[model samples]
Target: MAVPVESEAPGGRDVVGAVLKACMLLGQFSADRPVWTLNDLTTASGMNKTTVFRLMATLVQAGWVNRTDEGAYRVAMPVFEIGSAALAKLDIRSAAKPFMSDLATTFGNTAYLMVPAEQGAVCIDLLEGRNSLVVAGINVGSVMPYHAAAGPIVMLAHSKELRDRWIKPGLPAITEQTITDVNLLVEHLDEIEDAGYSLSVSDYLPGVAAVAAPILGSDGAVLASISVGGRAEEFEGAALAAKIEKVCAAGARITRIVRAMPRA
Candidate 1:
């Protein structure tokens, strides 16, 4: 979890108050404006100088933010750890995409690269199946909600942290078929975990069904995931399992390749 930025000593508010205000102030900066002066934060947050300086001092002390030579403030290196850890896990996605592409071409199933972050599996990259109808709805950078989408479900089933963190409450209802009930969803997720993959039919976008397998690391950690998706009507029951072998095979191959290579 990120420590929300805030500062004390401006109005001499309580420690909690300072933390909250600092967080609110830091939230004001982003990719476009990564650095800011005391006046800049004050204007953006509508807070006074006393508040901004105190807050920035706390941030600078905590290593969450830094001061530039020109006297501007910017976010520091802690954020990189989140991305780096995820990348170390998702290296399988880097290795397996091309192999999955071959399977997509062979089976005409759209292949997906699913990596968990911020309580969902982000579709970092994708390989379209040849028929165009193989996997129709999702695209690159599309997010798979924990309940409905096969990628997140499979990844979550493989990750204790993900299952406990994401599959709890407020599961977004992407479609009428989306599962929001915790108990019912848990039963299904349990089955996915036992089976070593996750499967879903129209739980996310309508008319789409997907099968996913967990991509693991060399140390037996659930790294990322891979999925095969097609139209729900055309691919159900027997048809779905028919493709699972190749999907799992591709996923396993991808994981081995990723685990063998040095972290980039």
Candidate 2:
């Protein structure tokens, strides 16, 4: 039998080309384009038809991809399980759950735990409260931009890199209320950092409101954010004030927990 030689990735790192190809195929499936026929997938990936079929078949056998009755391909349940498992391993998520539950219960809104991502912030966990509607705003795994929502704003306010990216002129407005002006956004970020929390009204999503505070590591770096969000009307007056206080308290508590844990 002829032995196959491994390929070198950039920087002289040896990599399994087949595995990389499989991942490339998997990346094509997304929220907007969840299913793909073999022909379409081949064209979209710009890979040979036979290669696409073989990799997809391997993925199907491994339970990462599923073949539809009509011959289209979509991601399988195991992918979601793997994503959930990854989220579960984060110490911040484990530490913040109790506080998130309390915030949801107390405010009758939704409480969320978000971590900073390269593109923005990712909602890793969520608890819907007593008054949660059928469409209670963003879902778990939703990626929010640093310029828009409360959670990402906390991240942007705390991180110099994110702040630099955000202050660049002509950032797209997520909604009419989203701050697009660089000068005003700079002022807004300063206010959030000064107050130790962020409040947004109809910014990321219309008619939605949220308050969030940053969870900081011992070194003063932001590890994550805890937030509560609901209909804009609910976040007003003394009620809003109470929510802000609770959220900030939750964030502080989680920060303490994170600092005490042994670093991996």
Candidate 3:
């Protein structure tokens, strides 16, 4: 699991605090104010002059920031490379969006598109249905655990590497229904793989349910997942089955679209 980014220093861990401060310093640069000197950065960020200098020097060394002969700093090529990489990942989101919209409209629930991340899975896009009460705490850019939610579980079921990394002892529980037991979760992932979809109830969030399926690459590798989620009470036997079928179909369609895209 990726260590959580903390704003404050934890016991015997100052790296997180340093990372946070560096990010804060970087935030001061934008199109409007693209370049900054040590004095400007320290004053604008309200950080110690020595700290700002150290951070700037580190960023320059790391190729994330560039320093001019005049001692002004600007974001560097690596930053643009990172941005381009993120935009490339959004291609899958574009391919899956129409199907997600259809799922949301037909089911009167929320449809989510999630892509695998270093830590787990990230919700890249979400379309809300006509349901009166929207499920809370989940929005675009929300990072979900690989063992809990239907989307992440679908991801875990399809990827052996993710399963090996995430399905270990003492998996954190987000709700009472969350499967923290390593053996049981392993069995559950096998079932999900055999079924080619996942049905989750109140696992990640209270009173919420979701059905998800994997969107596979041309080589059959799991690329991402698509899911429909709403109130737990609304998901029952036949209704849940129909949702599973729809979500799986959506996943298949998106896989085709992604495959048809021109390769970079």
- Expressed as tens digits, the lDDT of each residue in 1-264 for candidate 2 is 111213342334476677877887887776568999999888877777887899999999999999899989999999977756555555878889999999989988888899888887999999999997434346788888889999999989998877866568888998899998989989999989999999999898888899999999888887899999999999999999999989998998788667766667
Error of 3 at 234 (Å): 1.2
Model 2 TM-score is: 0.65
> Per lDDT, what order, best first?
3, 2, 1
lDDT of 3 by residue, 129-229 (tens): 99824767778888889999899999999998888778888889999999999889989999999999999999998889999999998788889999999
Candidate 2 at residue 45, lDDT? 74
- List candidate 3 stretches off by more than 4 Å: 1-90
Single out the weakest 10-residue window by summed lDDT for candidate 1. Answer: 1-10
lDDT of 3 at 166: 80
- In the range 8-118, model 1's lDDT, one tens digit per residue, is 434444446766687787777655578888887877777767868888998899998889999889988985465456556565556776877876787676778878788
State the C-alpha lDDT per candidate.
Answer: 0.75, 0.85, 0.85
How many clashing pairs in candidate 1? 5
Give TM-scores for every candidate, taking all chains together and pairing residue i with residue i.
0.61, 0.65, 0.65
